[model samples]
Target: MKFHMLHRVYLLAGVSYFATAPDVLADPVSLLATAIQGFLLSSTAIAATATGAIATIAANAIVIGGLAAVSLLGGRRGGAIKPSDAKSTFEAADSSVIEGIGRVRVGGMKAFGNTDGSTRWRLVARLQGPIDAIEAYYVGGREVVVDPDGSVTSPPWPKRSGGSWMKIEDKLGTGSETAWSALVTAFPSLWTSAHRVRGIAQSLVTYYNPGLTSGTYLKLYQAGVPDTEWLARASKIYDPRTGLTAWSDNGILACAHVLRRDPAFGFDGFDWDLIAASANKADVLVATKTGTEKRSRVSGMWAWESERGATMQQLMDSAGVVLRMTDAGKIWFDLIDDVPTSEIDFDPIDIVEYSWKSGPEAVERPNICRLEYYSPERNYDMAEIDLSGIAWARVQDEIDRYGPKYLDIKLPFCPSASQAQRIARRMFALSRADSGVMRTNMVGLAAWGRYYGQITEPDTGDIELVSLAAPEIDDEAGLVDIPFAIWPTLSAWNPAVDEADAPDEVPELGYTSDIPQPNAPTAMVQVVYPDTSREFRIGFSLTGTYDLSEANYRTYTGALPNGWTAMTEGTNFAYVAGDLEGVTVDCRVRIFNGEDGSPFSEILNGIVAIDNTAPTMPVASSGGIDAGTLNVSVHGTSLNMVAIRMRKRIYNDILGWGDWFDVVTYAGRPMQDLNFSDSAASQEVQWLLQCLTSNGTEGPGLVYHYTPPAP
Candidate 1:
């Protein structure tokens, strides 16, 4: 519910891209194939550009929006994608599934799987969606090319009529999904016209039950798949210019797609035509890559499972794309390149009311930017490049003047270091320019600009490029307030020209600033040394943030007012023994940047701190059956984590165990949400059973790795 305020210049409440989101293991190129995580901010707001037909309510209202610093770069944070479960059919139905973007290979969770007597079985697995198409499907970890007739074509299967083989079917998961023909034919009572899995990309396999032996007799069904993998071209984007939906890693197209599908934004419709035009414009403004063929200035893979606004912001910021709504309540997309013309050139004296900020405060603006990216060659792990010393960027002189610390930029989708370097340079350049924001409330509506325009400074009279502008309506005041942000030029970002920048005279201070010391350490806390060890005595870690300047860090601790002495030191981050000799009550940390040291920052005000680790493995198994209902329990003990939720399912001898189901949630005494759904069983039914987490996401191993004592 809280919003992140970027320094003093602007504050983001609802619907801000620079907003802070939840701790999640977001996708890194190949997505959930790896548990790599990154952070995005959170907030509750109306749709970004598609506020739909309703722009204003009744009387007095605030249309929350405007251009703010896109908080793109920072250190990676915590999170988890939905765990890949082999028995997903038995999983909770309400749990939000992982939806993907770009090219990805992820496991599927079954929504439903059933059988017809002893001969046939059907498994419907829903992968993250609404996806574009499946490029390949794997069974038993091997690729199988499925023919259109639903027969196994490439892997070669018996063309037997008595259900001796398997056939595969796929649905792109649109809003309107037709029920499977085979399922409807075999189980007409259960799979009727109403049995549609809409908005979920699903793959269904109709084959001879894998469980049957030559006479694979006794077993009724097999719940376990040898292995299932789906590799596909995820989320196709619609190009307004081309009027076509195709496979593209275009960040703008990606943003457009998610916004359209995610109804949480509360928009009746969108201006797709406008978005398409802007995307076309963005494509021409290229950032050069050494050995790659890239057509757009910004394009990258994204597999985010977070807040809708925050996700959209990632696509927009990564490509320098901007979204704005005009006073007429129409949405417009603007690319941050060169401005060819002004919608309305404004001079301060003519405006009714105005607030002009030249840019961010001196201390807040960054002189150097360090871009971290996922490299394909590095197996999608993170890598970094610096954006200083480039002639077109902030340069060494600027660094000497302002570079006390470097900004952390993450391009989770940019796979090339060279491309990352180019984007990082532009970001640093944009940050350094006088990013003036003009908040003027004018009486006449026509005075406002539709897109990028020009603003004449009150004192200097110099023209600037308007980067963004969002118009606000104040019906009571009878005035339209449009706040616009601008750069100090009329030229677009040119990679070729900027790459050739090499200043003749360099400052003696070079890249190092003259500041006496570095900033105090940040994200300082205690941690468990060997993760999952549960040994709290090993760590009081310091995540020393100023990587560009600091050489190392020093820690001192002592009881309340007693004397403080050096405890230890670390180059970038440090983890030291807790419950140690001198460590007590107060923990003080300072950074030494080779030249000088920073002021000590006090942390852990007596209360000991420990880093958040994975939830403990399910331990202490206990199960019993009462009145035909099976009850089983497992517990994991850890100081850093708490069990956020719990679920239960029933075990099947043949089909294995079904997915875990959550307790019904409603509202009661205080009328709170998430109250239990059902109090008792409706009829002679499926018995209840309980289970838990999978690999990597919850533990170093299977969290609920348990078999209840034989009943």
Candidate 2:
């Protein structure tokens, strides 16, 4: 069973129940409180109390595998010992680095024989500092404090007779009893009894923190000991490995020399595969080429530039590494991958042109189109249409006649009740045509829209009746209301297929319904050029002609034309000018199923330039030269206008080109709030001003610079 299932079973089964005898009944209040505590404890895995009492268990109680307790040890305490009092007055030790204003002292390492039968190592660090210093020890032992009379107070430990020392396990060395013997295990042939003596002497420094141990260990391994007496005491340590011992000293140096400096430079962060594939080159040109200036700079890397304006070719003749800053602001580091046997060079402009030409290839393909069909009554009414059938017979016929990619079709008028069936029939015909060579994806079905709020038919049922009614839905019970519908919810959805052999995973279909749901009253749509807002309208009169001015309630106050009625009013559609005012007006229309009041078709797939706001120019209100500084005027509306870019330019030879500044940018906020003022005196602002004011020094001559503020 699953873990959760087992837990549930245990909870239900472990709960005990008891019945009270007639003579003695349990206390109701106490029992109820106990029950609540029991439930909480069992469900939450926490210890709980009923009347504010605690519970105790055996020493071996299994409280669960993952519980831990906080240590009673608190924060660091105290003051340091002065360096002047290091000798007689304080307990003195050699090489112990101590600190403190008061005379609190701590002893360094002390060697001792391993009297206990636990391990072969023995070393103890006595605590001579204040009482709080005991908390810093890895393994705490007996603590002793000396009074003014030199009397001692010894603190007892739970276990005594044995002191703690970090044990070093040995498996591959001779004379293993001594520390020096173990240190030389890396090179067995060089070991001797004298070397074991040195290991003992060096062990004191080795058994400390990493920084102290690393520095001392490398010195001992490389230079042996500094004193001749110490060297003479352990001269047997000398071996052929002594000179090459640097490989084991530092990680970075070891890896760089032993690995990368080899014949095959094994650097990690480079593209090794590409380097290996290039026939005659040790390094491949992996940088992405962008912009002419960067390419020119990279090509002239080996050349020198003089303060007198001498060009690269005029100063140098050999190749070298060059760094070029690309127009797109990428730093390209060019290295000497291979040297040419003969003299080789190219003009900067020529190199720039070559770099530009070595980019990716562009391809051209035929255009493709997509279409959708919707019905009116049933939520889902379309049936599978034979793709080879008459779906786009008329459209195809027209296409074949005029030999054009675009075509349209008009269907015979049908009543709202049978609209679903008619649409399904047309969908099947189009599907049938799709299966053939003529791709029918471009065609779309537009369910005829209704005027007013109700759809009608003539008495004979042979002629369709159209009426103009109120735009308000409540007033359209007897009038015409446009309705839309589609079929096979999942049929229109296409799943992306995996290029490899992996099976495609099915995704859950998010909320979508055929039932009528309320939609926003004022919805927007967009359309492309030639289809202006004023020229677009949806209506039905058994003829293709319809006037939009006669359809809107406000514009058609006199009366709706022929079979139309008012449904609702307001700015449903506006011209390009409306879009310029930070508004989006779509020219697409929606068809609704009047009965359910739900959308039954696509989102019209309108094609309007969503970015309609024109680019704006920046107006400087005040920021150009106040108190020897530039206090210019600047004020702008629609500053984020997509089409425009704002920039400032200045010239001042006193400061270099490195000092220029721009406005601050934040989401939907004024740039002035982040303005730079001369009085501010910030290092960054000052440097930027200096750079901007300077001309012909690392900066182009007085050209306007545009920089978008950081997000």
Question: Which candidate gets the maximum lDDT versus the true structure?
Answer: 1
TM per candidate comes to 0.46, 0.14
All models: lDDT? 0.44, 0.21
Candidate 2 regions off by >4 Å? 1-615, 620-625, 628-711
- The residue-level lDDT of candidate 2 at 482 comes to 24
Query: Residue 666: error of model 1 in Å?
Result: 77
Clashes of each: 25, 63
Poorest 10 consecutive residues of model 2 by lDDT?
296-305
Which candidate comes out best when scored by TM-score? Answer: 1
- The positional error of residue 581 in candidate 1, measured at the CA in angstroms, is 80
